[model samples]
Target: MMTIKNSPASQPMLSMTGFAATESRFTGGLLLIELRAVNHRYLELNVKIDDNLRQFEAQVRELLQSRLGRGKVECRINLKSDAAVANLTLNPEMVGQIAQTLAALQQHFPQAQPVNLVEVLKLPGVCQTESIDTEAMAQSLLNGLSQAIDELIAARQREGEKLKQVLLDRLQGVREQISIVKPLLPALISQYQDKLTTKLREAMQAEDDRVRQEIVLYAQRIDVDEELARLNAHIVEMDRILTAGGTMGKKLDFLMQEMNREANTLGSKSVAIETTQVSMQLKVLIEQMREQIQNIE
Candidate 1:
């Protein structure tokens, strides 16, 4: 089954490969979001964010799906507290708790080594960073993601333009190959009839009617006009799809298969070395275009 990779109708063809990263500062921390996309049959998303920001993963996925139509996308988010605002301050409550616990311990073992103030301060929860506002952080995260996605789509657009040119050149090559073979058909048939007539004359001096019938059969077997016509039609459709420029990956792929089938038929009916060469050239061009189309979205 073929899968269509959809892109915006108003936009040019897009390649499903790009990379973008954005960083922004919020109330208490800085947020960094990075997005990378590669070709895929469908839109697949993998989002990785800090444990504290896991709550926003669903939101990130939704945002990406809204902006992108197709690709395997990987998103990474990192949030770090600002050095100036995040300075660790002593926890007065924790300190008081520690003092009360120490006094209780001393009552039982008064002779034990006195608790070191430096060591006590090093204990967990003894120091804490300023709390961040979740709402503000979420806003910052979304904003950064939006920017990164914009950059990624722009990169894909540039890559898509290059791919479009490559496909166009391959299509032109296919036309050239078809041109080379069309003129050879009549001459090839004539040569075949002459060779058959010569053989028949040497063997038994066959009647003219019999020889003509044999020539007609040979011509019918090797005729490739139908194949050529189909090939031309497929080429025209491909060109139209490329020009229209939206969700064409699957359509172009299907056309490539059809063109390849016709080329195979042309090769099988080859009456001359020139026709065989043309068939091979056509296959090569079609394969090249198919390879490029795989990356299109």
Candidate 2:
């Protein structure tokens, strides 16, 4: 039996998509277990098993829930008699004896039915099938199921590593966009002040205290420094969460929402073409991360 265990600190981001299969043979039967998983907001398990294996469904469900955090998981278990295990062999001697007896009976009663091969096979000892060991079959089923789960988790982890790298790349893209927006802020303020001064001088023909106050207020309104700062903070937290990965799907998603909110605010306060483009690019990157996060567990 294979035991699947991982320390929380060592656990990586796990994708909810995976597949695995395992089988074990007993006295006269073969037990097969298969697992499939796909993304879901919560753990959703559906188990299907042979009628004889119904008794073990609860145990299988418990085992899956204990190891998996989130996914729509489907488990299928089947038990079937293996011909090799049954060891079906013809008893040549028995067949010869039965044939002789049937021939003799037919001669004595001419009207008697001709030798019926089916009836001969039905006679005692003419055909035999190995008896199944119920207990052994049960144990093999549980052990095979354990091994299958281990394989499924391994597949999920491999996929998760890929998702993690994608998310990290998108986060870097978001940082790049933010950096672009920061340098443009000072230039944007200067440009806005110049434009406002031109309009005021054209109407009043003089610069005054009123003009300075209006410029300050307009700069404050368009300042996205605070939103950018918060976005950077969210990115830092997201990096930390990814580094310490363990069921961080929901947390990463929430952080994405926060980042998007900041991006929206930045766009709303945009006073220049460069700032508007930065805001849109930031939102695109954050949306990409959020889409990938949905598949993480």
lDDT for position 179 in model 1: 91
* Residue 13 CA displacement from its true place in model 2, Å: 1.2
lDDT of 1 at 127: 91
lDDT of 1 at 166: 98
Q: TM-scores across all candidates?
A: 0.87, 0.82
lDDT string for model 1 (1-297, tens) is: 999998656558899999999998898988988999999999999998999899998999899999998899999999888888887899999999999999999999989998888998789999998888889999999999999999999999899999999999999999999998888888988998889899999999999898999989988998899999999999899888888886788889999999999999999999778888889989889999999999998
Model 1: CA > 4 A from native? 1-10, 92-126
Leading candidate by lDDT: 1
Q: Model 2 — which ten-residue stretch has the worst lDDT? A: 4-13
The models' CA-based lDDT, in order, is: 0.91, 0.88
lDDT tens per residue, model 2, 196-257: 88988998876677778988998899988899899989989998998998889999989999
